[model samples]
Target: MKKRINNHQRSTIKKVMNYIRRYWGYLGMSIVLAAVTVALTLYLPVLTGRAVDLILEKGVVDFAGILAILKKMAVIILLTAAAQWIMNACNNKITYNIIRDIRKEAFEKIERLPLKYIDGHSCGEIVSRVIADVDQFADGLLMGFTQFFTGIVTILGTLIFMLTISVKITVAVVVITPVSLLVASFIAKKTFSMFKLQSETRGEQTAFIEEMIGNQKVVQAFSHEDEALEKFDEINGRLQKCSLRAIFFSSITNPATRFVNSLVYAVVGVVGAFTAIAGGISVGQLSALLSYANQYTKPFNEISGVVTELQNALACAARVFELMEEPSEVPDAPDAVNLEEADGHVALEHVSFSYVPEQKLIEDFNLSVKPGQRVAIVGPTGCGKTTLINLLMRFYDTNSGTIRVSGVPVNDMTRKSLRNNYGMVLQETWLRSGTIRDNIVMGKPDATDEEVIAAAKASHAHSFIKRLPHGYDTVMAEDGGNLSQGQKQLLCITRVMLCLPPMLILDEATSSIDTRTEIKIQEAFAKMMKGRTSFIVAHRLSTIQEADIILVMKDGHIIEQGRHEELLAKKGFYANLYESQFVNTSSQA
Candidate 1:
């Protein structure tokens, strides 16, 4: 399992590198500049030591020589500073551009993903990957690269300079350097799993928060506030534990590496003092060697600190890659053609489907509807009513057999073209944060202002809309939070009315509205369905009483099919359902 995880991490790293490859030229330039900066910095100690020697020679200060060396050193320092600034600018540009591309790709992947994938994952978790995780990845990369390139050059250049002065001191420095790296590596290994768990828990906590807040009304209605709080506490506690564990492990890396670095510096100083006394190296060379020793060990401390951040970034990247790797919706068929003018004739033959293969939701379903027919489906909540709509709309293809629209198999037509022929108004109304006019015109983007008002009037939404502060131009809050539920439904209905596609689907579209408003909307629907094939899925028997055909379903099969009055006369499942609702309504009255 550990090997498999390592392999997966390696794959994710390679994917990120591909994005980095796009800005290779800029990255290369940054590295070159960083190297030059480090080289200039390394030369400064040599000049300082030489100046010290010049001032000490024969106990007489050579002021003129020292001044010349100081001027040259100042020039080097200025150039180093300039190069460092330009290098940082390049690093920032590269980091931000790569993150921008990553965000763009992640969002586009969400668009192409199958509905099943979206339904199976929490919305908050998905959002966390696209926003929070990606943001963390970008920040880590920025720090990691900034330290990594310069630290490497400093370590290598310092070691080479030290070797030229005295191999004995250089050998001692090398022996102690491994201790710092080993300490960093061990702590990093221990913290990797902790950070991974923390990231996962954080996503779960975010998802719970999103779910709870979005359904606040339901919680209040059912008096579930205490339960919600308890659940939130449980998730929050888990996240705290994971975070503490990760932070504890990561906090040890820097101090431990720094301790090892200090040991190397002290040993080099002591050994170089002895070598200088023996005349094996000059005072100037001894001073330069001491400075080089610090430079050599300092990168290890910086690198150790960065290891913790990079580990956290890796965990976040793994999650983002996992989402991107999920299979997208099956591609359109190579020879698929556009559905230009559908005739509103639909047929299903030997069709079967299931959300999970082990649990069949629809099996051997067969149906045929002619143009201009209205078919109403009535069933228990779990008895394949909405599943049939999913199949017709190709949200999920049938597991076996085929569905045809106007004598052409659905699979043979492009999904966009196939869906364009149908307009749907679902029980759960949806409105984005936009003007009332924007919401109404979504069904037909190029719709005229006059046409939008006509649809709103037909759906009984005009009066309330006119009362808003800006009428049609009023901006809505997220999900139309400012509007009442019934009013939101009216807006949704108006959207469909504006489009008036060849095929119409009403999935309990009026469930949230009052009885009077429902009647008005039904009258409008009656007019709209005049020359279109309509499918109505409803639990209220009164709504489908006038349907041309009513199909009663149970256990994934159609148990009865006939006109509503005819089914009532037969006293079967449909009759029982109609009688129960009627009795409930009469009692309430």
Candidate 2:
């Protein structure tokens, strides 16, 4: 079931509560412990009043009675501390466990999200929601559970205890405390919007930092350091402005409520003194009333601080929930069939699409390939060569029309199944932080050691692997940053070689390799694609000369199609493109 939360406080609160409800047993125990702690804490003041009564006159004091009261006070104090400690432990467990679940769910959501969503957002912004935002939320929620829960209980307990001592004094304290509420509420409203802006600016700053750090080499290469710093300063300045405003607004809450609290305390002291002098209450009773009044007002100070923090937490939680609740890639049909084996007859008909509605990229695009044809797609940049392959793999569904594999509409097949039948080697390689063998076995984890070595040899990567200290077992730096670009591309090819799927999509797969290795890889690919369907997207026209069919694409349309010789014979766009590459190469030579 797809669950969406409306952008309203009530709905957000409801969702937060739903998470808490999962750990209700611990929450219930924490609340019960809080109540017990408050009860003992409130009673200790009463015992102190009793001890004071016994010692009003030094010579007339009943030492035995005073001693008994002191002992009781000590026990109550100990129990109160114990209960509070236990409650805090429970709060930490609940808060962090919820954080763990939220992060897990957020990552799983990222996996299922459409490519359009991933393409639209910055990596650091998404990371902020999962890591920084969730951590902030956990801190605020822990505060709410630890102090906010017990603070309210303490306030209520003190009120009841105060009323028992003298209703007039209690009434006086009550009348003055609402002023604290008014102050806190006013500050809280202003802080919420300020904190929301602060959270957003923080995400932008994080994204900018990640971008600059990840591409530091490029920034240095093009002498973009100064410009990048100026941009960074601009973002940093905005973040500082938002953070200062949020802090300024929320900082007023505690002191404003504290001032009102002092007023309540002043009233209690003055009223209780009058009551003591008038015999309306004994000296000891008046002292207890004053203690209860302080206790009652203390919660306002704590809760005001909590409310300010909760505003920021709520803002962060909103971002995390938005990420988790985003509609995932359109789900496959309930009865979607899995293509265990495919003969690789692929077709696209009347395909029209665009990243944005106002601009079209591919329109009325049509293509058909037989079971074992080797098709090469050549195009200038932004002519929809890669986009066509993305469509074929169902990365982004076409705006209109249908793509099919083995005569089955892709929509009717499970994405995993459709992707499983095709081995893809993109120009941009991805390698995780693991052994070389691990990266190679990503497509076929259960492949035997011999299979892995054979694939590496076929892709000309075996010699490099042998030279490494630990061969295939050596772990890689993140994304294989330790290897040369050509070496990385070879490993990517090695990975696909192991998969040996019925179909293949090689998008500039050999663009990074040297000419010497390129020939070796071409020979390997030729043998590999002998009886399987293949789609090769390339810019170097010479590399694909032997392809069975050449598709020359321009402006999302196939302007020329035939064998390399036939296309050159026509002297069209393909002829000029093929000829221009050699002209540039000869000039460079």
RMSD of each: 1.5, 2.5
Which consecutive 10 residues in model 1 have the weakest lDDT in total?
Answer: 1-10
lDDT (CA) for every model shown?
0.91, 0.90
What are the clashing pairs of model 1? none
In model 2, which runs have C-alpha deviations exceeding 4 angstroms? Answer: 1-7, 587-589
Over 1-589, each residue of candidate 2 has an lDDT whose tens digit, in order, gives 1122223445666789999999999999999999999999889888888878888575898899988888888888899889889998999989988998999999999999999999999998999889999988888899989889989999889989998888888888888777888898788777777777888889998998988988899999999999999999999999999999999988888888888888888888888898788889888887788788778888888898998898888878888998999999999999999999889899999989888999879999889999989999998999999989999899999999989899999999999999999999999999999999999999999999999999999999999999999999999999999999999999999999999999999999998999999999999999999889999999988878999899999888889899999999999999899879998779899
Candidate 2 overall lDDT versus native: 0.90
Clash pairs, model 2 backbone: none
**Which candidate ranks first by lDDT, i.e. highest?**
1
Q: What is the lDDT of candidate 1?
A: 0.91
What TM-score against the true fold does each predicted structure earn? 0.97, 0.97
For model 2, where is the 10-residue window of minimal lDDT? Answer: 1-10
